[model samples]
Target: MATKEFDELALDGTNYPIRASNIKINFASRGILNTIEEPNDGDPEIEPRKLNTALFLLRLYIHKDLKHEYMLETSPLNLWKALKERYDQQKELIWPEANYEWVHLRLQDFKTMAEYNHAVHNICSKLKFCEQEPTEAKKIEKTLSTMLPEDRILTQQYRTNNFQKHSLLIHTLTQAERHHELSLKNAQQRPPGSAPLPEVHFNVQNNAKNKKGFKGNSSNNPKNLTGKRKRNNNRRKFKDRKKGKGKDKAPQPRSNGNKHCNMCGSDTHVAKDCRIPKHLVLLYQKSLKDKKSSENPRFEAHFNLTHEERLEVASSHQAPVELESNINVLPEDVAPLSAMDDMFIEYCSTDPLGDLQ
Candidate 1:
């Protein structure tokens, strides 16, 4: 099976520490770290199985060329020791880089405080791996020294307040940066200036100017021109100008007074040009005919016709009720109304109103 969790460890003298660490972690996980850490002191017969397992893991992660050469080794412990001896020398080669990076680590070189903090931690880790870990004081001093020139005063302020704690210094820097970004954003959104007046204010001022001094026509009483009249006026004015009637002059009226149409009574057009609705003209002609033939009119309107129709409709669906006489008829056995009057006069003459006897 494939145990290649990482890139194959090249035979070249590069990137051996990280690869070896990964290999160790992989062996520890498989319960076979002991094969490399200690010898197989339990059983002689089981020794060959463990040796093959360890060799398989190592070969799975090593270069193809190194695989064939390392197969000749019979012991896992000696092979582990030999691999370390050949690859572990790169640490010395990495020391100069750690020192150079440490000297050049500048907070100003990174855009954010978080990025600078990350760089500091990363460089410190690299140094610690190479046995050159930085102290707390050295890290703070490095940060203070590498700040941008504009922030030199800010560094002094932090130090004056005894912000020797690296965490406190970082917190202060981050807060100050946040406040600075907010201020810049606010400044860009709206600058320091008086606000301009609204649209209605300008319109009112222009209207006031025109009302106070404009003399040819009052602003209140503008010439009411219909759309068609305005178009005709413009067409006639253009023709007149082409004929050299006048230049830069107001258009002349078509007549001494506006042409009044008798059909519709609109002053913009004469009777010939009037466009009265046909329904309205027809009704008018009907009114004249009705007046001329009032006694024998063509359209004879019956008054209260809807009431008569309603009574007819109500009786149409109902059966007729027969009656020989109405309730006003008196029966033969009843006395006449003259006898009723005599009885009433006799009852009245008896003096029922005399003292309550």
Candidate 2:
């Protein structure tokens, strides 16, 4: 019975000369060895057709120069033998030391496991053709040694377990590569020590509503009500002082131009009508008192004067106090005052009487 028909080999010239020659030899060994050795005179068509097919495939692989040189040969066996001789001669001419070095250097430089495996297999195949085939253990050892640092450990472990099967080793390494890629992806997805902060959005409408509610509750707040009463009482005391001064001396002609408030540095208002903070107003008043005491040391010496005498001096020489434009009263200046001082100032501001009884 005829043997099973093997698939016809298709060769491309780019394949290594050794690989192409091996394939051609395998094709001949399959069923055609006898037909190539002893020609059948009975069936002229069958033998020639098989030989021609082999010759056609061989022609497809060789370079144009080699094709022109070998195409004149009529016998398929002769043509195949001639091609083998040419490739063998070429292989013999190549330096074994150079080939060994080339293979060793490139085996280590492969970026991926698949590339490394393919290169190792191809080099081994070439070495086998040259009758220098390395053992499986040596191949495995070489592959593990040449791998990158991270991959070397896993490859070494597989080798230690005596997993000398090339296919199985490649599969395990491929799986490891996939796991490494997944780990890297996960690490990149969420950076270390970096979590998103919860956002707090402010609602302008709610703030406005709260402000309205505060204004509505102002009358109910004891501090606000007391402050309003104190302001009104102060205004009445000021008006009373002005009336008393008017009675003593005829008022001088008031300027028609707008008055600039020395306290607030505003042209729209006078100093008396200035809305300067209570703390700043008290500080300004203290400064004025200090200046007057310095200019007239006699006034400070007469501190034991009767209440009526002090009032007389205060009303007669009421000098217009001017605040410096550059004076800035920050919250920190008033913050240092003791509770007792704050209470006394609050009491003095609320009191209807301007001075000590």
lDDT of each: 0.73, 0.63
Taking all chains together, the TM-score of candidate 2 against the true structure is 0.42
* lDDT computed for candidate 2: 0.63
Give the C-alpha miss distance for residue 355 in model 1, angstroms. 99
Q: Give lDDT tens digits, candidate 1, residues 206-243.
A: 88988786556433444534655788999998997788
Off by over 4 Å in 2: 1-60, 93-108, 147-156, 193-357
User: Candidate 2 deviates by what RMSD?
Assistant: 24.3
The digit string of per-residue lDDT tens for model 2 on 40-76 reads: 6785554677677666655555567777787698776
TM-score per prediction, in order, is: 0.47, 0.42
The per-prediction CA RMSD against the true structure, in angstroms, equals 34.7, 24.3
Error of 2 at 239 (Å): 64
lDDT of 1 at 7: 89
